[model samples]
Target: MSPTRSTRALRAVDAPQSTLSAAAGELIDADPLFVRERTAASELPDPAPLVSNLARSVVEVISGVRDIEQLSRWVTDDVYRHLLIRTQHAARARQARRRPTRRPNFVELSVRIQATTENIVDAVVVLDFGARVRAVTVRLEGLDRRWRASAIHVL
Candidate 1:
């Protein structure tokens, strides 16, 4: 058989019918029990303490004093990846400078949290690092019955 003939035969056997039944559409619309439902902001705990702690922990991770894995459970995958990259860069810089890994001397100046929706909150955490001040912005979303950081930015 020619190559084109065999390819066509295989495609015909492997391809599924494009028609979708009403039952399938209904199933798609129905909520599955296996998937966790997002919780409302009101149902979640106050985000101030968590935001402050997370900001501090993030700074520590970037300063080589804390592990990025410790913050994984509280942040989304994208945020975790971003933190991991920052941590690695920080570690390399510290290594290049031959600096000791020590806890950062920082104080939480203030935390401001605002609710944008029923399940979303935006927070800004201010920190005083003795000589410099920094702000960490975190977006918290209620997911799986808890508040998780979906986005974080340090400036």
Candidate 2:
């Protein structure tokens, strides 16, 4: 109840290390950049918070055939249903060609997705390969409790 008692209670809890301080110790950089909410969420989350993070992981996961299954795990249910799998099959297969080398190589892609929700959502994503962002698509889905992307059309 007292100020001193409250201060002591707060001090007893372990505090998170500031990312910048941790980075400073590791000698990583001066420019501070970080995506925080790997966990915390409130009643209202951002309209499109996961874009940068998901983009980063999507490349790593899809880099190998073995990891392809992981894609379904991150995405919400019905994403696969709406995704243009049959349509993109040909292009994806073509891109899957392993070059003549000691190991198979998956094509590197930078995927950008824009998502917004009202009663429903419209998501537009562009996958940028070095040559170009070879693919762009718009998907529509009902705004369930969590973000879900369904039905797609290439643009």
Candidate 3:
């Protein structure tokens, strides 16, 4: 065959390869893994329930009704440790003052979710313990499809 005809034949063979490569690239671009990743990343639990549960857990801890294990289930590791230390100190202070630490009588509780990202939320919670009202700011993180309180600040 002439060089011209040989070059044409070579191009004909490579034409299908290039077409196939393009189709394969499209398929990869539309892969299910990408879809799944996007869906998972965007899927976030409603912050209302999470904030309510966290607020209740904090109240339970402050009332001395919930133990460390129970608190751990609702809060992150750092919050758990912080709660333990604070509760211990409160207990010691109560003992020194010879005052009985009464369980808080929760009259009302309200939770307001301030901000939310893909995997994090900031919530403001107000709890009415009959004679006193406590406001708590909670930072929550989504991990393994569950919301856990990463930090809590009471005001």
Error of 3 at 117 (Å): 1.9
Best by lDDT: 1
**Best candidate, TM-score-wise?**
1
Candidate 2 runs further than 4 Å off: 1-44, 51-66, 73-78, 81-117, 138-144, 152-155
The sequence of per-residue lDDT tens digits that candidate 1 reaches over residues 49-138 is 899999999998899878888998999988999889888888899899999899999888899999999999999999999999999999
Model 2, 1-155: lDDT tens digits are 55697786575454456854575556644434421122212333553544433443444433332343554644644554434254255346656784321222234243444434343444444555545553334343333344433443443
Error of model 3, residue 44, in angstroms = 3.6
Ranking by TM-score: 1, 3, 2
C-alpha lDDT values of all predictions: 0.89, 0.42, 0.73
lDDT of 3 by residue, 1-155 (tens): 45798897787677878797787778877896533121222466677876776777776776567666776776877898888888788778878889886766775467777655667778898888777898988987776666778898777
Give the winner by lDDT: 2 or 3.
3
TM-score of 1: 0.77
* Candidate 1 ranges beyond 4 A from true positions: 1-36
Estimate the TM-score of every prediction: 0.77, 0.37, 0.66
Total clashing pairs for each candidate: 0, 0, 0
